[model samples]
Target chain A: MHEAAARNGITARFGLDFPSFALDVDLVLPARGVTAIFGPSGSGKTTVLRCVAGLERATTGFLAYDGQVWQDEARRVFVPTHRRPIGVVFQEASLFQHLSVMGNLKYGMTRAGLSPEQAGLDAIVALLGIEHLLARGTKTLSGGERQRIAIARALLRRPRLLLMDEPLAALDLKRKSEILPYLERLHDELDIPILYVSHAPEEVARLADHLVLMDGGKVIAQGPLSETMGRLDLASRFADDVSVVLPVTIGAHDDDDLTRLDFASGAIVVGRRPEPVGRKLRCRIRARDVSLSLGNHADMSIVNILPATVTALGETPVPGHILVETALSGGERLVARITKRSSTQLGIRPGVPVYAQVKAVALFGE
Target chain B: MLTGDDVQAILLTLRLAATTVALLLLIGTPIAWWLARTKSRLKGPVGALVALPLVLPPTVIGFYMLVAMGPWGPIGKLSSALGLGTLPFTFTGIVIASVVYSMPFVVQPIQNAFEAMGNRPLEVAATLGANPVSAFFTVALPLARPGFVTATILGFAHTVGEFGVVLMVGGNIPGKTRLISVQIYDHVEAMEYANAHWLAGGMLVFSFLVLLALYSRRKDRVDA
Candidate 1:
């Protein structure tokens, strides 16, 4: 497993100390797809991203990207941020106020020794949907437009890795929604690994394939998104926002204003989605929306019920509540938060058979 | 109408101001950049030293400069060792003194501009593959342009209007050190009120126009 990871992964070990806070993290993240560094505010998510970009020098650090050491404090090998093949998008749009949109896009390209055509500047502009905004001055742009341009500028540098520090945090909800599609496009079309720092769980569920949960400058958990998010022990850290992300495909659209989503387990139905059949989507199922029953009730109003066995149970921060981990027949996992009394009443224990009724699913596009 | 002597003084003053502004900018940029970004304990002492010219009388600076450039002084000794002779009472002497006298005018504005820019642009530039020197020229320098404008204008205007420093360091060479302010003093002492009026009034109008242009441009930037 270690050999496989070393062949195609980023191995980062950083220890940084500040007066009020300290960051110590050792992460081995996959080289492809988006990996989210997630936690509540002040969990040192941004610090980890900064260390990877060489923006913050860790006191004791070892960082290697795909077997090439970018920083090794022991060997006295350190590549400065400019020398590293990485692009960064700060929280704010941070566009150069002195340059036009086109100028900003070309700013990194010229420095990277790549011509406009060579950097695929036109394709990137079209990818971010900023072609019409090329000649506009940065000051005249809206929040969403500026962020789009910033992303395009980062891409124009032809980076091997992209570090995004809450790129959507500074924008209002309206602007965030406006820019999310472009971000989704980048994830689909680009092959670069993205280290995204976000405190927003919804954004993580919608975008991330792997999850690294951090708290108080330490890694609490890290794994594939579904397995990590479904962990019973880490449920309380999510507080009232406990949920799991499932990779599902559009199986079919029923005539009765509903659509079926197929996962590794049996399919579940949601309200009719506009996406075509066979298109993949990520759906976040909040643990609070799931309920457990001792027997499958065919007469219930809930239509998406599947046979599951209780895997584990853990206490939540909420009074008298327990988070129950269950594995469906086909091995997909789900977490259902239930009252302690209800768990006892339903005989919900490890190895107990039960049915999981999913009350809601929030679909995120592929 | 201006006399030939008056024209010579005016030309000399312009030349001194131009030379002083150029020298101050070259020397002040690094100082201002350091003041803006450094966390060293020496920042306080260094900043106070730079601003000393703004508070102290110009004659105090001129007196020290005069002594330092005298034949017996250290700078004079170095100059002689280099076979360049003494510097006092020469155009070069007055130009050096003017640079010291106007140092604050050039450095403070640029420092303020760099501080206001924060570290975001430079960090962004670095992540975009610009080295430190490249970042400064491409990012820091261009963003601090308004400060440069302010510094150039203030440095030029302050150097042109200087009196005590020029009088102490350069004495009154005919076509070299006798600037407009000294010429105006000369006219008044000689009871040539008409001549003083022509030059001094010109100085007044010119200073006002320069300030007006600067402030209006600043207002435009603020509004934008």
Candidate 2:
């Protein structure tokens, strides 16, 4: 019945109030690249992922990706999970407990009408760094290793898109770090699109080319990571910004223990970007930690900036400053707020400009 | 010292247990898998049919098998056409009846194991590239090892203890299917208490040991 969605975008008619679980997500983002869906607990991130995978039915909606339409009430198109060209990596890394690490990956590839020879077993093994784990039993694997194998196994199906529901959520810090590179590499190396669900803003910032923010089953904000989280009114709308993630290309490493993170227009001076040369990193900025700046301060080296295009300008109930946004030419985006008095003195308006200097540590931690 | 009849019954019972267990395994595995996975409307009826012998009298199963395998039934017709003659009152007939009567013992554990495994592993297999059938083979079967063992042993032990079914289907044909259970009953009825005691005691020990072995091994596997 998902044939309708196979034709175009998924349109959920359920609106923002889901009667059953009270979750309402409405977004028809391009089904290519990584569209990360983030939310707090009970925010329905997994449910949305499940919906796209066709695991669970949406009360009312139409989902379409690429050229394939998955669900549509108007057309009555619905595709069963097996018939869908999608792969899912569950939060539990549900490896076939009966099979070896190698066998688990091979299981789905074998069914996808691709023989071991055709699927290139070694490529996946190498990509997930599971060569040594091939013969090992699934029961013996560490949480991170299991998830890597789970991802590898899902990939072998040659699916058009991948669905990962916090695949790294079960891992410890060390394992999460260890597996992050592979995930990053996977996004770059594969041609297929991915829809990742996570509560970790760090993952969204670093991995998502597009972000769909969810709260209480609704799409609160969506678009590129910086643009979406860069909304000034976002913090006041919610108690505090859950996470503010930004993607930046490395510019250079400064001698003063700060790395030059080249954004869209200006460079940010974060302590370090943990990647090799030319690697992209998702650095986080917490709203609670950020403050407004009118211009570059000579005495301070606290290095992030907002060239301050006023994406939004208004009085906040907190009786502080007006929130502002500035889009950089580099395609990178930032957010800042100056006091209402500062806005008046600096003559900031919807299109007026200013600077948003960031503190050394903002909402950037895991 | 026991007579030649006692020894003959012992050998016959062993042969029956071994044959029944092997046949049950071959026949029960596929049936259990089907019962475990299929959601057909007939599943309830078919499952009950498989379990019928466990609760019903053994003589009923033996009588049905005898009728189905007699010179008048299709199987009997086919056997005679092939020059195999009548099936009733033969070792083969006894074996078939035992397989039917002990079916639930073999199938239930296997079905439970399959049910417990759930669809997760199979789905995982499908996503990995295995088609449905291969996934069942590669992922489902291996995990049900302990259940298979339990079914086989229980079926074999139950078959060894059968008296009524063997009597109805195969009769007390010496050196053929005059099983130990019938022999023990015969001795007791004839007031041959000592001989009955010997055979009954042996059977009790054998069954206890089989159960002990099955459970101990199962516990170890599970614990491991």
Candidate 3:
């Protein structure tokens, strides 16, 4: 183990051989904020989270969280799941059927040798907006309500790390929207680092500060969310979902029923937003929605035209289309997907200035 | 109106049933838990052994138990070594035979309940800082309450209704080993039809009420 690296972040190396599949991964994740493990289905994302939670014992594995060794196969030292300070919310809201809502929340607190007041049970219940549900049975709660209770129960354990495995996958769209705000609040308020396993790109773009991309039981790419999402070489892997997440501030609401959002590079105006001015938000710009021209066209209807320089070009899965990687004057990156014919006609190359017209921008409220 | 002999028999029967149910519950819980959760190859053979008394005649179990507790049998030798002499024709002897005869009644329902719970609750409990032992007591036990209730009633009722095993092992001793079922059998043998009718009708009503309670509760659980 590298002492300096282990002290600052989580270090994990795991290898397992199953009859149908094999998993081998080496990861160093930051010790704070949400880090999403994103991949397609059957890509071993959940398995990675399970291994971290000490639920699945990898045949050959070593894991250390912020300098505390949890598993080391060579030393024959392994801490069992219950002994590790972790809170896990499984895909299904696995609340105890025999326990009431409040009973379920207190189950972990009692085991941790803390009373309800000491564990701050009331605050957690209020955070999840489940105070009215304390007296109800688990069977009668809706899917979203049950999930809220499950999250609250996990939190009451006072875990040092939290692992969520697609906690919203089982809920309908309406239920998902209802629960997403609570998750955002957790990401904002909680000091514990969260390891979230998700295959949904929207969830990753909206919530993750750091990203780990996986495929076929392996880690393909990992870094800060914006840096990794803008890599041209990995653009084909994202396929139609290639987009960049940019942190922007609500600048002002204009008189023409529009709101302006300002990032490092420049400002973009969109339909009126309900948030107050100066509030921070995240916006996603898809590669397919961007078009580049050699000279600015003032007569065009597009309002988000910004001058950028092409940095690199990479091949996409589509035969004729190519991915264009560019940098704004302020050092923020953007990607645009265009045809091979347009690339040759405009003689687009690295360091060539071009005007990028962003056709749409999707904003995610914080 | 019942005779003094009949009253004594009823008391002895209740005592035997209560003792057998208590012993079965203690011994059956771990076996049922293992059967419900184990993936070992011994599961098949062990399950078959527990269920053997359900299909085999009580006389067979009684015959083997009688031989085992006799003067020269292995159990008899051990008891003699421990200063217990022999166990046949004693209240203790009948209680052991009743436990063996009603083994399946206590184990199967509890095993079914544990199996129906799946592995989710235990996993949840473990993540909540409960060790395996703590989870069993806090989560698994409460979740399987219905199974315990069914097992208790079935074990007690089966022990009270057993005649062949008790008669074969206990030899119909008057107050010491004579139970309600054995007493009713002796009455019929003596051509005392009136006494037989009194004891037999009571047994019939008791059995009906037990089954009624079990099924009605099952219906309520289904409705819930």
TM-score of the A-chain for all models:
0.96, 0.80, 0.96
In candidate 2, what are the lDDT values of residues B5-29, reduced to their tens digit? Answer: 9999999889988999898989998
Output DockQ, candidate 2: 0.37
Give the better candidate number (2 or 3) by lDDT.
3
Q: What TM-score does each of the candidates earn?
A: 0.97, 0.79, 0.95
lDDT of each: 0.92, 0.76, 0.91
TM-score of 2: 0.79
Q: Write the per-residue lDDT of candidate 2 for residues A93-163, one digit (tens) a residue.
A: 89877667777776678667798778777787788898888889988788998899889888887888898
Greater lDDT among 1 and 2 belongs to 1
- Using lDDT as the measure, the top candidate is 1
Fnat: each model in turn: 0.83, 0.55, 0.83
Q: Where does the lowest 10-residue lDDT sum fall in candidate 2 chain A? A: A8-17
**Model 2, global lDDT:** 0.76
Give candidate 2 misplaced runs (Cα > 4 Å): A1-31, A40-86, A108-123, A213-222, A231-244, A272-279, A293-310, A313-333, A336-354, A361-366, B38-97, B165-171, B175-177
Residue A317 accuracy (lDDT) in model 2:
45
Q: Clashing pairs in model 1?
A: none
